[model samples]
Target: MGGSKTSLAFLVLLLIGLLSGTSSDAHSLSYNFTINPRPRPGQPWCEVQGEVDQKVFVSCDCDRAEIKYLSPLGEEVKSMNAWETQTGTLRDIGDLLKEHVSDVTPERHMVTDPLTLQARMTCRCEDDRHISGSWQFGLNGQMSLHFDSENGHWRVDHPGGRWMKEKWENDRAVTEFLKKVSMGDCPAWLQDFMVCWEKMLKTSDAHSLCYNFTIDPQPRPGEPWCVVQGQVDENVFLSYDCGGAKIQSTSPLGEEVKATHTWEIQTETLRDIGDFLKGQLSDVILEKHTARGPLTLQARMTCQCGENGHINGSWQFGLNGQMCLLFDSENGRWSVGHSGWSHMKEKWENDRAVTDFLQRVSMGDCRAWCKNFMVRWEEMLKSTASPTSGPPAVQPTATAIGFTIGIAVGVAAGFGIIILGWIIYKMR
Candidate 1:
């Protein structure tokens, strides 16, 4: 009985050791550290580099994992275990091993994470005196971690760090500039210009901004003068002189035009005239006219199509050298006559000259009229009696000959009918 009790006590102690070991294994402690930068699209990976406390303790709830060392570059160094043994340190001094080491073959291990949503990292390194294995944090959705030994220290490296930093700086600068401009806090000199500039930007009309400034020339008293005008591009500091109806660009990209004018102002408001001309030619000027001559008047005239399907018009010169003209397209005709005093003979001569000119202008359509005239001539020849020819008047003779032929045919039909009647009566 004593031997049996001792055996029972030994079995109870062994059962207690197994239960305690399973409970410890089920409730193992884990440490997780994260370092998140601001979220940005197209960024490859988020990095986490920090250290953990030395003492290994068991806990159910924790707010944050403790960081033990802060490197010179402000990163944290941490260590963890990969295997379930829990008997050896995973990482030690001067061990450069990346997280998420993957083994493709039985012998070769590559540090890569194919999944984009989650990442599992494990690293190990050994020297003659020290051996280390690192258990890193898991990431989701495709990520990769790199490790390197720099100056006898281990550090995590991000590949796209420099590009991301530059992009961030550029975005910040543009945003700040826009904010300041929108708030109307720009410089005094630029405030007025900004109103137009912002309108151009919103509309995206480069042409309007191409010519924003203007110059108006004033005339001295008692002198007829010309106005000089200029325009400037707001974006580029380019100026164009439009004084001569000519454009001179201040920059290579500036646009220029040569302008011409028919009217000149001697007593009108220079500002008003300048504004008017500017409206007409957006970037042109009106230069002074050194020579003078009689004003030439020209008018645009149109004629409707007539029954002949043609349009016609003519210009008539007057005695005063002015012109008065009337065009009649409805009847395919035109009349041009002068009224100024010269002489009766001269007036008639001038009228004939004008008529001849009209005829020359309408010569293309004259072919139709010529064809009608020839047709009328042919009809007249067939209807009229010959004056000096052998053919004489024979209308009465021709009528008598037709009447005689009709009487002869009637007598022949009557005789043939009588003969047929007599033969029928005899046969009956």
Candidate 2:
């Protein structure tokens, strides 16, 4: 039982030791420093202060403060202000110094100056009383210090340091320098590099307008026609000529006007061909068909108008091999001459009458000829048999001449055979 009691006591002691060790480690690892709520900025008596290892220190005065540390040989170490020093346990102080100073050594020295005596003594502690090769104090009663690993030198984290401001000013200077270097218009080669930039910047409508103006064609037939299709502003114009005739029109607006002058083929000029046409036809008609071909016929005609104002159209005739009527129009008058085919020349002789009629009717000479030809041709077809007919031609018989020739040939063959036999007999 005693042995068991001893084991229990040992276990309890072990647990207590572990708990105490854990608490100590926790305490050493973390620290915080806060301004006394009683002191405010801008107050006459307001001051900043801090402590390290329970050692009180003044960081800054109401007006200003300076902290200074000296080595045993009285060499100045590091100095900063109250707010710049971090207050924490030894482990936290080590970590803080490691963050600012690379390869921080375990040793350090520091000092701070606060103008007010109250602030200087306000920061006091027991843990930081001892000093070995180094010691630390807050600047303006704040901030922290530790040894730099690289040189075993002390460093202070001064929160109010001017490093950040200096860096920002340097950056601004660099940017301004770059701006100066890049000043001025781009090089000419670079300017030329963007040849299509203007086109790219134009609106779609403008692009389309330019393309339309430069690239389309318009044409008119009959005349020595040339067409130009292009845009002017936003409007398109097409121009052309038709056989010396000219018409100008606009699309979308549909505005058009045309004027042309063509020659008049006079009745006298047509009369010469009228008889020739009648010779080719069998009969003719006037408005209506009759057993006799009409002396004059109403004809529908088409005239080809030349630029020189000459009119031309074909004329037709009747089966009797005569010109029964003359269809001709000149200027504006359409005329169906009442003269028979044989009188075509006489009909043409009255130039004044023919001219008057053509002018009054607005029918050209060729138009009149075409009209008259159609009337005559229709009448002739009606009075005559079908156009396909002529006479019922007699078919010649296959004569006995062929039989006679055959018989002659057979007799000649018999004679040739008989002569050959006679010759053979003579040879034998």
Clashes of each: 20, 66
Cα lDDT over the full model 2: 0.26
lDDT of 1 by residue, 1-428 (tens): 56555655564555455433321000001122221122224321222221111111211101123322222211111232211111111121101112211211111112231221111222111111011122221122111222111111122222222332233234544334322221112121122222233332221111111111222233224322222222111112222222343333333222211121201221122233334433422111121112321111111122212334433432221111112223332333333322211332243344655345334433333223323322333333222212223211121232234335545545555554555455445545
lDDT of each: 0.24, 0.26
- Candidate 1: misplaced stretches above 4 Å? 1-201, 204-207, 210-245, 255-428
lDDT tens digits by residue: candidate 2, 148-238: 1112233443332233223323454432321221111111111221232223222211111100000001111331211222222212322
TM-score quality measure for candidate 1: 0.14
lDDT (Cα, 0-100) at 297 in candidate 1: 18
Predicted structure 1: lDDT: 0.24
Looking at candidate 2, the ten consecutive residues that score lowest on lDDT are: 207-216
